[model samples]
Target: MLQQNLYNWRLVILATAFSGASALIYELITSRILLLFFGSALTSLTIVLIIFLGGLSLGAALMTIFKKRISSTGLVFSILQLTIAFYGILILSQFINLPKLFDALAKLISSPLLLQFTGGAIFILIPTVLLGAIFPLAIAMIIDGPNDQISSRIGWLYTLDVLGSVTGAALAGFFIMPNYGHTATIVLAGSLNILAALIVFPAGKKLRLAWLIFILLFTIVAGLAIRNQKMYVIPKNLATIKDPYRQSKNIDIIGQKDILWEKASPWGVITVTEEETELGLDKILNIDNWGQCSVLSHQSESLIADGALGGKPEADVLNIGLGCGFTLASVLNNNPHQVTVAEINPVIYEAAQFFKEYTNNAIDDPKVNIIIKDGAEFLRTSQEKYDVIVIDIEHPMIAHSSPLYTIEYFRYAKEHLKTDGRVALWGYMSSDPRYLKSLVNTFKAVFDNVVFAEFEEPNYVYLFLASDGELDVKTIDTKGNAEKLLESLASIEDVAPNTLDNQILQKYFK
Candidate 1:
C-alpha cells in the first residue's frame, strides 16, 4: 500500500507540471485574441493581466475553503483539468464571434473600459479559475500519506510547475505561434490539459472506460475544429461596434476589402488590401489593421516631398518608412540625386513589388537605395548627412511607434541634418488636440523653426517642416501654400514635449 501511494504521488506531480504549462500557454494565446477586440492600449493589457491573475487567486481561495471536503483528491484534480480543457477549446472556437458580443455589450454599457472588463470576465476568468484550483488540490492528494512532508513536497511540485511554465512560454512564443498560428497554439495547450487529466484520473476500473471515452471524443472534436477553422478571419459584424472618434475606421476598411496578401510577424500582422476607391483600384498596406499608406494618394505624397525638400533639386534625401513606395515615388518624380529608404519590415519591401506600377518603378531605380533596418537606429549609425530627412511612419498611438516620436529620436535626426537642410514629419490632424500639441512640442524641442503644411483635399495629412534656421515659405513653390501652411502651424496649442523618459503622447492619447 505504501509503494502504491508513492507511485500515485509521482503521477500527480507530473500531471501538475503539465497543467501549469497548459495554463500559461492558454494565457499567451488568449491575450493575442483579446487584443483584436480591445485596441492595444496599455490599460487594456493591464486589465487582461489582472483578470487572468485574479481568476487564479480566486480559484486558490475557493480550494483552500473546501480542502476538508475534497475526499477524492485525484478525482477532483482530474475533473478540474478536464473542465479547463473543455472551456479553453470552447472559448477558442467561439473567439471569432467576440466582436459582435462586444458590440452588443457596448450598447448596454457606454463606457469602453467597463465593456472590456465585462468581456474579459466572461471569456477568460472562468477556465482560469478552474486552472488555479488544480495546484492546491494536487498538493492535497500528494500530502495524504503520513510519511509525506507537506511543505517539502509542495515546494518540489511547485518547482516543477514553474519549470513547465517557463518551457511553455518559450514554446508558445518561439515555436507554436510562429509556425502553427494562434488557433493551433490554443489546441496544443488544450491537449496538454487533457493529457494531465488522463494522468491524474482516479486509479480504478469503475470510471476508467467512461473517462477514456470522454477524452477521446473531445480530442477528435477539437482536432477537427482546429483543422477546419480559417486563420485570422475578421468577423462580418465587427463594423457594428461603433467608434465615435473614427480611430478604428481603418480596421473597418480592412474588413470590407479583399486581402491580396497577409503575413504574421513578431512585430504585427502585415496585410496588403485592394479596394475600389473614387480614384480607382487603391492598393493599401496595413500593420495590424492600422492603415500605413496607399498607392492612390500621389498628390499627397508629392506635397509631402515638396514641403520637405524645400524646392531643392537633385538633392540627397533620406526617407524613413517605405509605405507602398508612394513617398519614394513622389521624391523620384522630383529627380532626386539619391533617395535612401529605411524600412524595418522586409515583408513591406516584398509587398511593395505589387505596387511597382503605382510607384513608377521607384524600387528598381538606381538612385533609390532601400535598406531594411530600424529608422531610429539607422539615423544614429549613419555617417552621411542628408539635404532632407522625411519621417513618415505609422501613427504614434500604435504600439512600438512611440519610440520614433520621442525627443531622443528627433535629436538623432537633427544631428544628421546639414546646416541648411530641413526635416519633414507626417502626422494626421484627426487626432486629439492634446496629442497633436505634444507631437508639435516634441518637434520644436529639436528644431528652432517649424512650420506645417496641409495636404490637398480628401487627405487629412499635416506635414511638419522643421529647420535650425527660419523656414522660408517661398520654398513651398506653390502659390499661397506657404502662408496657409504657416497659419495652420500658428494655431496649434502648446503642450509638453514627448521624451524617452516621459512619453506623453502614448500616455494621454491612448
Candidate 2:
C-alpha cells in the first residue's frame, strides 16, 4: 500500500527533494554570503538562521493561504512555479544590490541586539514561508479528485518528500555546489521547479523553449562565477551577534584547476590545490580542519614556534585546525619539530592541498604527521602530552562550539598539558567592547596565569599566554622579540582566548 503511494507521487517527490536541496544550499549560502564584508561568526550566523527560518515560516504561512484551494496536480504545479519565482527573486536580491542593502540594514539598526533580532528575522521571512507550503500543497494536488483518500496519500507523499529532502541535502552539500558553483546550483534548483511544473502540466514547445532560456541564463551566471567574481554585498563593520566574540568573514574559492571545491558551510570556503612548493623546508599540506604542513616545514627550518603550548614542544608536536597550515607553517619557520596535526574536515585538507596554496613538501619533513580528528575530543582520549598545544578554532556562530570555550573544556586542556606545557589561542577582535570582555572571561575560568597582549596592526589580536606556573610574556619582551612576536601574532586570526578577566567578561554579562 505504501509503496503504491510512493509510485504515484514519485515526480512530485523528486521535485520536492530538488526544491529542498536548493533551499538548503541557499541557507548555506545565506550563512556565509556577506562574509567578505560583514563577517563575524555570531553576526553572520544570526543573519543566516533568520533568513533561513524566516523563509521557511513564510512558506508555511503561504501554505495556509492556499489551504485546500488547489485541488488538481496542475494547479499545484502552477502555484509551485509562483513560489519558486518568489524565492528566485529573494535569493537573487542578495547578490543583486547586495552592498546597498547590506549597508542600509546596518544603518537602520543602531543596537546590535535589535539588528540581530530583526535582521535575521527579516532575511528569512520570504523563503521560510514558501518552503513550508510545498508539502501540503503537493499532497493536495496529487490526491485523486475527491474520491482519492487524501489523508493517506498525503502522509505517504510526505514520507517520500522527506526522504527526497535528505538525499538532496547530502548530494548538494557534498557534491553539487562544490563542483558546480552557486549559480549552477541555483539553476539546478530552477530546473527542478520547471521539471515539476512539466510533470504536473506537461508543457508544449513554447513553454519548453522558455525553460531552455532559463537554463541559458543559469549557464551565463555560472560562467561569471567561474571568473572568480560574485554578485555579493559589501558590508560595513562585521558585528558579532553577542558582544566581544571572535569572528572573521571572507569569500573563498571552492574549485581551481579541475576539482570540486565550493563554499561548504558556515566555516569558510574549501578548495583542493596541488602540494607543489617547498623551500627546502619539510612540510605537510593540509586544509581547513586538519593539516600538518608546518610539521614538515619546521623539520626543514628547525625553527621553534610558541602559542597554546607552555613551552616549545618536543621533537614531535600535535597541532589542531589546519587553516592553510598557517600556524603550523609559522611553527616550522621557527623550530625543527616533528609535528602531528589533527584536522576534522577532510574537504578542507583536500582544498588546502589542491585549490589553495598548500604544499605536500611540508610533510616531507621527517618530523611532521597529520591526523583528522576533533581537538577537544582528541586531547581527551590521547595518551600523549605535548609541550605546546595550539587550540586555534574560533567558530562562535555555530552553537555546538560553545562548550569548547567553556571552563569545563579548559579543565580538560589543563590535564593534557605537561606540567610546564603552554597553550596558545588566537581570536579576532574588533571595535566592540562587549565581545572582547566576554572572550577574556571565558578563558579566565580555566587557567591560572592568563596574560594578554594587543597587536598594533589595527586588527587587535588578544594573545592569551597561560600556564599553571607563573609566566610573564613581558619577561620575554627584551629588545624587539616581544614586539616582533606581537606583530606577527596580530596578523594571525581565528581564536578563542581561555584567559578571561572577570571585569572584561562582566562588560558583556547580561
Candidate 3:
C-alpha cells in the first residue's frame, strides 16, 4: 500500500506553513544581508530589491512555459529551489567579497545605477525563478483534473505566505532578532525550511525519524556557533565581562577603561564603551560609524562626542532609527530631562531589559518615553517639543530605510522644534548630491539656521545642526541629572579631545 496519491490534508497544511516560514527567512536575508559591506546605501538597497523583484517577475512569466513539462508535485522542486537559493544568498552576503564584486560589476555594467540594479538582478534570478514557479507548479500537483477548482487552496496559501512575510518583517524589525543577533535568526529561519521539507516529502518512518533528529542536532549546534559569529576580540584597557546577550567575541574591557558593551539581537547591536586614558569608567569610546566601524581609538574617534554640544531645554532631541539600547543609553544618560525616542520597531520595547545598559535604570527613568512606531510617522504626530534627539539609524543599504530620510520627514522635524531648539542629523556619502541637496533644502524650508558640519581628523560624521532662532550654546544650564552626567564627562579630564590621547564623542558618551 504505497498510497502515493493518498497523502493526508495535514501534510499540505504543514507544507504551507513551512513555505511561509521559508519565505519570511529568505526575505529577511535578502533585504538585510549586505549591510556590513554596502552600508545600506540607497544604491545598495535599490539594487538588491529591484533585482530580486525583477527576477521574480521574470520567473513568474517563465513558469507558464515550464509548468506543462514538469513532473508531479511542484512542492518538492519549489522547496529544493528555496533551499539552494537560501544558501546562495548567505554565501553572497557573508562568505564572499560582494563589495569587490559590486565594484567590478559597476565597471562592467557602465552606468552606476544600472550596475547596482544588475548586481541585485543577477542574485535575484535563482530565487525568483523558483518562487515564480511555485504557484503554477503547486496547483498542477494538488488538483486531480485540469478543470478542478483549486482557487480556494491557491488563494489561502498565497494569503498565508504574504501574511507570514509581514509577520516576519515585524518580528525581525521590532523584536526577535534584535536581541538574538542575525546568525541565530538565520538558523531559526533555516530550521523552518527543513521542517517544511520533512513534512512535505517525508519518505518513510525510519527516514523521517532520522531527519527529525538531524534537524534537532543541526539547529542546536548552528544556533550556538553563529550566535557569536559577528564578534571578535578587540584590545582595550577595561575589565571585559562576558555578556551572553551580545555574543560578541570582540568585546573587551580595558581595565577601568571603556569597553564595547554591545547587545546584539535581531534589532542590531547596541554598543557602549569608553577609553582607558579617560577612565573613571566614563570616557566614551570614539566610534566612526555605528552602522559600520565601532572601533575604539585605533581606527579613529567619534565625530560628535557624547554630550559635546551640551544639553539644554527647548532642545528638540530626535532619535531617527532607534536600535537596541545604546541610543536609549545616550538619552537616559542625560535623563530627568524630557526625552523623545522614535523607534520604528516595536520589539525594541520588549528587549529593552536584555541589555544591562538600558534595562536596569535607563528605560525606567522618569524623563524617558518612547513611541513604538515609524520615526517619520512620529515626527508628523508630535505637537509637543524636545531638547535633544538622537538619529540612531542609517538609510536603505541592504533593505529599504528610505522613508526615514525623505524630505517629508525633515520637514516634520523642523516643525516640532522650539525656535531655539536644534536638530541633530546624520548623513553619509554613499549618496548622490541630489539626495544630499534635497536634505539640505528640506531642512532649510523649515528653519532659517542650518549648519552642515563634519568632524575632522578622527571620525567622518557629517552632522547637520539646524535652528529657527538663535545659536546659543552658552545659555543652557547643566543642573540635576545633566550635572551628574557632566561631572562624569569632566572626571575623564586626562582624556583630551582631538588627539591620540582621546576622541570627542568617546570622552563624553558616558
Best by lDDT: 1
Ranking, TM-score, top scorer first: 1, 2, 3
lDDT of 3 by residue, 439-463 (tens): 5555565668655543322444445
Query: What tens digits encode model 2's per-residue C-alpha lDDT throughout 15-128?
Result: 666566556655665554544334344556656776676666677667767575544545455456545643554355345355565567778878865665565555555555
The lDDT per prediction is 0.75, 0.51, 0.50
Worst 10 residues of 1 by lDDT: 243-252
> Which RMSD values do the candidates have, in order?
7.0, 10.7, 11.3
Poorly placed runs, candidate 1 (over 4 Å): 1-7, 144-148, 204-256, 276-281, 380-384, 456-459, 470-493, 507-510
Pitting candidate 1 against candidate 2, the one with the higher lDDT is 1
TM-scores vs. true structure, each candidate: 0.83, 0.67, 0.61
